[model samples]
Target: MITGDNQHAAMRVANHLGIAPELVFFKASPSDKKTVIQKFEQEGEKVMFVGDGVNDSPAMAQASIGVAINAATDITVQAAGIVLMSNDLNDVLKALAVSRRTLRQ
Candidate 1:
């Protein structure tokens, strides 16, 4: 997982998620997400982006799969292919776990 931040709160979120500071690319622009997505796409990786902010809309739309909370802004929800029913992070985690398990099967 990678993260970037223009604010301390953003950086703190990354840190809270246990993402290494080095792996977290902090920046003041949404272009950071675009750049990161481009790199992964260039590497032939299928990328999925999950976000609830307007700033994340562009990159999320660019990704192979975009997941957004139902409670997110209309722009974000519209850009995402998957609209999560729950606003809880734990619900997201559970969905991911289920997906992984199903894939393993």
Candidate 2:
């Protein structure tokens, strides 16, 4: 959960989501986010970046699967491979499930 939010806020959100605090990157710049995605790719990991802000465009574009909410900035929408029309974060899981089903066909 890489975010531009401050460390304290990031930690709080991470804790609530059951994500490790060490896995939460706080105060991340756009470049930093992109770098992290690239690092994951280098390590043979597939990254799925979900974002709504203009600042997230770079990382979204760098991700293997970029999902943008319908309410996201134009740049973010353009950078994403998929857009969630409902603008609900949970829709990401639904989308992934559908994709997996489609892939199995």
Candidate 3:
């Protein structure tokens, strides 16, 4: 998972949900997102990016799928393919579960 200082609070929430700190890559610059996405794409992995901050909107738009919470900024909501009504970080796991199920079908 890719994140930024702007999402530190949310990352803390994600950590509570069992997403390890090692899995989280925190970037302070928006430019870092491109490199992160590129690296994932190079590995042939489909990456879903989620965030509520403006700095993350770009990566969100470029990701295979973007999830934005209702509490997020308007820009993030606009860029996201899935706009979650709930703010709970646990909802992200639900989304991933749904995606996995759909893919299997």
Regions of candidate 2 where Cα sits further than 4 Å from its true position: none
Taken over the whole model, the C-alpha lDDT of each candidate is 0.78, 0.94, 0.80
Cα TM-score of candidate 1: 0.74
**Backbone clashes under 3 angstroms, per model:** 0, 0, 0
lDDT of 2 by residue, 1-105 (tens): 899999999999899889987788989999999999999899999999999999999999999999999889999999999999977788999999999999999
User: Each model's TM-score, in the order given?
Assistant: 0.74, 0.93, 0.75
lDDT of 3 by residue, 4-98 (tens): 66567748866776788666666546668857886787889888887887887888887888889878899999999998998887798898899
Worst 10 residues of 3 by lDDT: 22-31
- Model 1 — which ten-residue stretch has the worst lDDT? 1-10
lDDT of 1: 0.78
lDDT of 1 by residue, 26-101 (tens): 6635677877887888999988777888988888888887889867789999999878988787777777788889
Query: Which residue pairs clash within candidate 3?
Result: none
* Stretches of model 1 off by over 4 angstroms after superposition: 1-7
* Model 2 alpha-carbon miss at residue 37, Å: 0.7
Clash count, predicted structure 3: 0
lDDT over C-alpha atoms for residue 50 of model 1: 79
lDDT of 3 at 13: 60
Alpha-carbon RMSD to native, per candidate: 2.5, 1.0, 3.1
